[model samples]
Structures are given as C-alpha cells and as structure tokens.
Target: MKVYDVEGFPNPARVRIALAEKGATDKVEFIPVDVMGGEHRTDAFKAKNPDAVVPCLELDDGSHISQCTAITEYIDGTFDGPLLTGKTPQERARISMMNLRAESGLLNAVGDYFHHATPGLGPDLETDQCAEWGNKRKDVATRTMAYLDSVLDENDFLAGDTFSMADITAFAGLAFADFAQIDIPANLTNLSAWRAKVSARPSVSG
Candidate 1:
C-alpha cells in the first residue's frame, strides 16, 4: 500500500497517527505529494483521487481511498494492534458520531478559516476568499471546543472510556486549531486536560 500525502498537514497527520496506533506505519510506502506546488491539483494525481487531497491511500490492487476517516478505517481493520474504530456496533456508531462532530466542527472549520479568512498556502491555492463565512466557521470551532469539553467532563475519551478514532480526530482538530491561531479558552479545562493526556500518547508525542 502507498499513502500519498504532504506530511505534517492536519488531515494527513490524522491518517499517520492512525497507522502508528495500529503499529502499521512501516508496512506501507509513503509517497510525498507537493501540495504547495500544485502537484495534487494535477490531472495525474486526480486520477488516483478525484478529490485531489493528500493522505490518499492506494491499495496493492491499485484502488484508492480518499478522506481521513475512510483511510483510517482501512488501516484499523488491516493492521494488528489496538482497535481504533471500535469493535461493537454501538461503539462504532458512537465513535463515528463523535469523529464527524470533531471533523466538521473543529478540523474542517479551522481549514475553512485558514483557506478563506487568511492567506493560506499563498494566493495560488486559496483562490476563493470569503472572510465572513470563514469567521463564522471559526466561531463554530470555538463552540465545538466547548461542547467537547462538556462531553469530556463526563467521559475519559471523546467516544467513551477507551481511546478510539474519535479521540484521534479531535486531537488533530485541536492541533489544527492551534495552527489557525484559535485558542481553546482557559475555561475549557476538561478539554485542555484531555488534550494534555492525548498529547502524551506515543502515537502523537513520538
């Protein structure tokens, strides 16, 4: 398998963390994509992933999978290590719900703010600028931080007692938030604490 990505980017980081958690990081080949150079937008890369996004997974059979969640799912199922998505039906559903919430509310929101509100990746990539919508999404990211803090007040992890995919998504989201200059309020103590704990994990800290 090959992973096409720009290392250190938030979305790509999500998939990398997933692979590390599964102890499968060395099992696949990593193909670096020069997103800043417009390599991802090229037709050749588009053939593998029409989305033209980094962190795309190309299977041995030549099939490709885009999106962090989908790539994580494949990694979790194929690798031999701790489960990420979840084992039971209820666990899967809950993790999936929380993952979506984290992605949309924080991760994607930060992305919107970065690409639209700010001069992200320079003038070449960010062609359509919408400061108003980007600011609105920034507000959504803050609100979601509070919501996740409230949830963490009752649970050890985003999905439940165990560290699952939801935690991975939220952790990456918070990292993106930091990059976007969005601060997690000091009042969000639970969220801050949870982040500290997650940060200590080998998958992230290593």
Candidate 2:
C-alpha cells in the first residue's frame, strides 16, 4: 500500500497513529505532501483524491482510500491483529459516536483557529465579521477541549477500556491543537494525564 502523508496536519497524523498501532508503519510507502507549498491543490494530487486531502491510502489493487476514519477502519478490518474498532456492532457504534464527538469538539476547534487565525490559508482577512468569527472559533475550541477533558476523566480510552479508533482520532487531533499554540491548560488535568499516557505510546512518534 502507498500512503500520501503530510506532517504537521491532523488528519494524516491519525493515519500515522493507526499504522503505528497496527505495527504496520513500515509495511506501506509514505509519500509526503507539502501542504504549505499547495501540493495538495495540484491536478496530480487531485487526480488521486479530488478532495485534495492528505493521507490518501492507495492500495496495491489500484484502490484509493480517503478519510482518516475510513482508512483506519479498512486497515483494522483487512489486517489481522488487535482491532482498533470494537468487536460487536453496538461497540462499533459507540466507538463511532465517540470519534464524532471528538471531531465536533477538538477538530473543529483547531480548524477554527488555524483556518481563521493562521496565515497562508485564510480565504480573506479584510472583514470585521471574520475577525469576530475567529474569536468565536477560538472560544469554542477552548471550551470543547475543557469539555472533553471532563468526559475523559472517567475513562482510560475515549470509547472504553480497550483502545479504539476514537482514541487514535482524539489523540492525534489533540496533538494538532497542542502544536498550534493552544496549550493544554491546567484545568484539564485528566486530559493532561491521558495525553502523557498516549504520548508515551510508540505510535505517537511514528
């Protein structure tokens, strides 16, 4: 399999985490996409995935897989090992729900901050309302982080005791926020503690 990857990005990092978890990191080819250089917007890249997103998993069978969750699910299903998804249908549903929960809270927050406050990606910065929206986005992101921290206080993993795709998504998504100047404040003690555990895992690096 060939993986179109990009560092310093949330979605791609989730794939990387899944690969690391599966001990399949070296099994696939990694092609780095320079997002800052607009490589993802090129016709060549778009031909692979019209969405022009990073972490495109091109299978050996000439198949392409987009979306971090879908890619991870495919890997967990096709490969034989400890499944990142749940064992039962109800468990799978719960895990999916948790993953979406993190998306609305953690992912949206970082996006609101990055696409609005950061340069090189904002569409237009000339409007006052845009500034107001940016501020609001930052607020949502911060509060979401806090809310997730509380939710995490009761469990080891996002979905349950065993590690699931939701945990992978949450860990990588939160890592992105940490890189974007959004410090994990002291109020989120559970999150800080959980982060320490996740970061210690070998997958967090590769």
Specify the highest-lDDT model's number.
1
Question: How displaced is residue 177 in candidate 1, in Å?
Answer: 0.9
Report the CA-based lDDT of candidate 1 relative to the real structure: 0.94
Tens digits of per-residue lDDT for model 1, 78-177? 9999999989999999999999999999999999998889988899999989999999999999999999999999999999999999999999999988
Clash pairs, model 1 backbone: none
Candidate 2 lDDT, tens digit per residue, 64-146?
A: 98988889998888776678888999889989998887776777667666666665153443222345566677777788778
* Per-candidate local distance difference test: 0.94, 0.79
Q: Supply candidate 1's per-residue lDDT for 82.
A: 92
Error of 2 at 71 (Å): 0.7
Shift of residue 3 alpha carbon in model 2, Å:
0.5
Report clash pairs, candidate 2: none
Worst 10 residues of 2 by lDDT: 120-129
Please provide TM-scores, in order, for all candidate models, with all chains considered together.
0.99, 0.90
